[model samples]
Target: MTENTQHDVIRRNPLLEAAQEEMRKFERRENEFRRKDREERAAELQLPLAEIKVH
Candidate 1:
């Protein structure tokens, strides 16, 4: 077998495939959550509150 074929076999391992898929899912969720939090913080900061009126 050639060197390229050997490398392809290793890349096709089931355990490696599962681990890579899990990492992809985790990264996607992390990015989504971070983006949402950033948007919320930006919105909060943009709000204008002139004075605090206590009753």
Candidate 2:
């Protein structure tokens, strides 16, 4: 194979895949915390619960 073709070959990386999965889980947890915090603050301010957005 030519040098460029050899360099362009795709490879599977288990470490990178695992890291990405962990990152997704971390983001989900962070979003949940932020949503809860927002809800608490809104309740304290007496704002309507419907006006608070979690998504």
Candidate 3:
């Protein structure tokens, strides 16, 4: 197959696009929850806010 045709095939892959979108959403929610959980734990332990990284 031609290189142009191969590129077109990859660009038109709906399944890959959908999976990537799902992962983006999942990561956003995961980070949000993780940050909240860390904040709660920090408050409980009286730890400084500078030590936790949710990203």
Report the number of clashing residue pairs per model. 0, 0, 0
Query: Per-residue lDDT tens digits of candidate 1, residues 1-55?
Result: 6999988888789778899999999999999998677667757887433352312
- Summarize candidate 2's per-residue lDDT along 13-32 as a digit string, tens digits: 66678889999999999999
Which candidate would rank higher by lDDT, 1 or 2?
2
lDDT of 2 at 1: 69
Q: In model 3, state the lDDT of residue 26.
A: 100
- Per-residue lDDT tens digits of candidate 3, residues 2-53? 9999898888898789999999999999999998998899899998888655
Q: Which stretches of candidate 2 lie over 4 Å from their true place?
A: 1-12, 52-55
Please report the candidate that would top TM-score against the real structure: 2
Q: Rate the local accuracy (lDDT) of all candidates.
A: 0.77, 0.80, 0.89
- Runs in model 1 with CA error above 4 Å? 1-12, 47-55
TM-score of each: 0.61, 0.69, 0.66
Q: Residue 45's C-alpha lDDT in candidate 1?
A: 88
**Higher-TM-score candidate of 2 and 3:** 2
Looking at candidate 3, the ten consecutive residues that score lowest on lDDT are 46-55
